[model samples]
Target chain A: MSERVVAAAEEGQVVELRRSGRRPRAVANGVRAAAILVALVVLAVFPLVFSNPAVTTIAFFTLVFMTSTTAWNGFAGYSGYIPLGHAVFFGTGAYTLAIVAQDLHMPGGYGVFWLVPLAGAAALVVAIPFGLIALRTRRHTFVVITIAIFFIFQLLSFNLGITQGSSGIQTPTPPWFGGAFNIPFYYVGAVILVLSIAVSWFIRRSRFGLQTLAIRDDEDRARGLGVQVGRVKLVGYVISAIPVGMVGALYAYFIGQIFPQSAFDPLFDITIALMAFLGGLGTVSGPLLGALVLEPLQQYFTVSDPSYYLIAYGALFLIVILALPRGVVPTVGAWIGNRRARRAAPSPAAAGEASGGAPGGTRYAATVRSGE
Target chain B: MALLEMEDVRKSFGGLQALSACSLEVEEGSIAGLIGPNGSGKTTLFNIVTGYERIREGAVRFRGTAITNSTPERVFALGIGRTFQLTRIFTRLSVVENMLVATQRHEGWLRSVLRPAGSASEHRRAMELLDFVGIARLADAPAGTLSYGQRKLLDLACVLVADPSVILLDEPAGGINPTLIGLLAQRIRELNRQGKTFLIVEHNMEFVMSLCHRVTVMDFGKTIVSGPPDVVRSDRRVLDAYLGTEEADGDEAP
Candidate 1:
């Protein structure tokens, strides 16, 4: 019976090992499409289900955090350029919107809704010069420089008084949205969150995405192969900054205030980086997973035991990094893939024969030959 | 006229002179071999010409255009493609994706944003390159999973995708299996037939002699010899450099 099963598997006939009749390539693509569809559906329905005022408020905050984290993930996870001071972009967007809305008195929602993206554009403009200097340095050095930029901007915001100095500005809520503290704001936040995720997903599969992966894997090799490493990375940094800026603007409107310390918080940067790392650095679903899993823990900590929460979050990060360096998604994905591969096979010999007959079989044979 | 010329190129790393006035010329459409013992500055010369290392006191001219101190991207844009001694592939990407990266396309941030979902031409071209290298079956396989030989072929395919006029292959068959070496030799010949100029740095005498039309030998950051394969093989200096005194005597006896 085992022999018959093995023969059938090798022959590509009726076998338990066959996951689907569709090609493996098609199946993998199908899985990705389904995941995107599911995420879109969830985002659309989230605000309706959580009708409570408090729940809506928390959801809004979560969405903002998600947007910033997703943007951070694009550079840190995909391109391997760790921006330790990403709060600069976030703060820039927030302040730009704040100054325009509060001091200049740009129509209320115009500042929160429209000007936020404009702030993102300003961040992009800043990113060009910053990238030229920052990207020239190595990874750790770039991180340090990014951190310094954050400090510099934070100091500027405090001293200039344009952003209301240390006291910060009080942004007005748009009248159409029924003030900052409303359920409708939750829907707006959801839109931003969904848009951020969609744009990130789009970039990940695009030609630029391929180039970024190439750059991440080996910058020198990518350059040698005709990839414009500097330009590619600069664009990635700029794109990442936009969403972060939008999130900051939203945060300011939601709370009706913006402080230098709050806007340029190191904790927010660390949280986004930690969330991205915890979920899976290079996977599309990583940021979302990280946010979804950790945000609740954060809320619980803030409510139940605020003091211990910091320690808990830090410890969790350390534990996750030490235990699963590839982040949760990749580690779990690999585990599931391996498990499937194992369970589908009755014995090692049968499995070998089946694999030897598969599409990767010839390459495997070539690899073995090269090994010798 | 020489298609590419390096005139007394000099490079130093702090106290060590990596290239001491090293100079050589590669004629258009010719397969030029650069051979030297370990730490003999062959790679330094390649690096200087390819713009990876700066030349301190010499000029590098390609097709009568000065390219000394140019960036690697500029060099690549000028139709010079190179492969490393140890293959450097985009490990996580599919084989086809690796090839697509080498193809020239409008890659600005805006263009990427507005670019269509699927690129049939790019895909077809990448597949054609893969087929040329005999790795079409592995087109969808992640490059990291490929064997060393396959990776070498993929690397070659990537360079070819750039549609370069000149290719610098650093030790193409350095650590490959004997079977793959034969394949590499055949491919090099096939590519040469298509009018692509090659500057190869290899240690395998048999492979080098069989593939290269002319050989340029280097030692101690200077050109030791430059001639056709037969002339180079018979040169006493070539024998002395490759075999040393004791080994030269062994070869002389045989």
Candidate 2:
């Protein structure tokens, strides 16, 4: 009567065992807070802890690489648009700072620092039209378009007399502030890394993040659900470009020079992309973790044998892709989550009691119900 | 006046003529059904009204505002929400996260980045809808893992979280179990009682007959008959449209 057995069976298994919320917000928040505290402590004392000029230099580069990769991951990783030529923005930022400072005869140190944001702004502006055109085509097409743009910029820098042709422009070093200039540059790089990470964290939990993920999952469905796909992508592109641009400006200043080949290096894009993929594509900290691991490895390889470094890099990438296809963070997270779920599963007697139904009757009824 | 109105809407994909001179209306608080044999432009009409596809001929008005060629987001903002024939939930996201995405609006771009995903009230409403759909327990489960029937329910819940005045459901009973179909019907009736207007395109005759306040039958992208289910079910033209497709090929006389 009134589908009594059906109701009992549903209560017995599915309804009885089901947990409403699984996010574990409190525990996650605590863990995140603790991790942030530990990271900040380590970062603050890093220069002091290492006390080696070579180590500090490498650490500075690591921070710069982490900032750029994290910024790239914010949009490309989240939206599933592999930007093959993201170096466009990075190069643009470097070149903009170089051109402006040279053309304007700007003084070094704080005077030039004032225009760093302008470099970032220039890259952001450039990304708008480029993103609009490139995002019109998706997946592989978009990747190709980005690569085309990057190479075009590279060729322009090499040929344009305004950019000093192939010889490149020599940047003025910033006014030294107490000891080696690299110390201040290191701290600045660290600050940029922290800012980029914060931006990534913010976007990952924001409404904008949800829309991007929706687009990544299915563009048509996202549009159908009232997400302005074109506009969201453009905004995300601009945001992503801003940090990379700032980093480029910093890098140009740090090295006291900007060359067409180095400023617009295609390897920058490839390396950052590889870093993001190696860690976890969509996770906020993935790119940072990736940069930490891969940048040091690259540095070591480059010092040992610069010519064969790239071959080794390629081999390492293939190994990661073949062995851990889902990347480290997600693969490990999924494994731990599955184990936890198994341990959390209720026993049969406990499940029956929780269901508030006759054990034997509901168990038999549940078997029949599941057969459908 | 009808809550939603389509006046002589016509659409064509090159030469196929997906919809031709189609017109229908859904009154306030009524469950209106659109049915056809296979492809009589039922979905086409729904697409036109929801702004998924453009209408070549006529106008679509919602609450007396002409929204003939409005974008899907504009249509949704105007309180018209819809679900696809095939369920289109964001597969990688959790069920609650999917619901939150649907509840989002196109506001300030910077604000979206600055603010968190959904307000407390929005979260409450999303959870309530999930509960109403009987899938609250699966709120954190990735949507891809859900059964086809459960995905369908989640799809409906996503639309409901928007709290639209009018909902367009394309094939609400397609490929679902009978028990779930009955539950779906009950939910529709309950929502209708609360003054939510629905325009549903369903192939299941029994489900439509039991749930729809009135039914419209279409043949060859034209409305063949429109009335109460019993009347449309027994109409000569309707029967011919469903049973003998060849006989109803030519244009009907005015």
Instruction: Output the number of the DockQ-best candidate.
Output: 1
Q: What is the DockQ of candidate 2?
A: 0.37
lDDT of 2 by residue, B122-151 (tens): 889999999998888767556665668888
Best candidate, TM-score: 1
Give every candidate's TM-score on chain A.
0.84, 0.86
- Supply the TM-score for candidate 1: 0.89
**Per-residue error at B114 for model 2, in Å?**
1.6
Instruction: Write the residue-wise lDDT of candidate 1 on A1-372 in tens digits.
Output: 011111223121212223234465476678868977987887777667766666666667778778788888887777888898788888888887788776566666543577767787877877778777888886889899888887888899889957779988888766665233465566667777878777787887777877887888789888887778888898888888888887777777777888999998988888988888898886667777888878877887898889998999889889988997767777666554444554656687877766534434333222212111
Docking class of 1: acceptable
Could you tell me every candidate's TM-score relative to the true structure? 0.89, 0.89
lDDT of 1 at B83: 91
Flag clash pairs in model 1. none
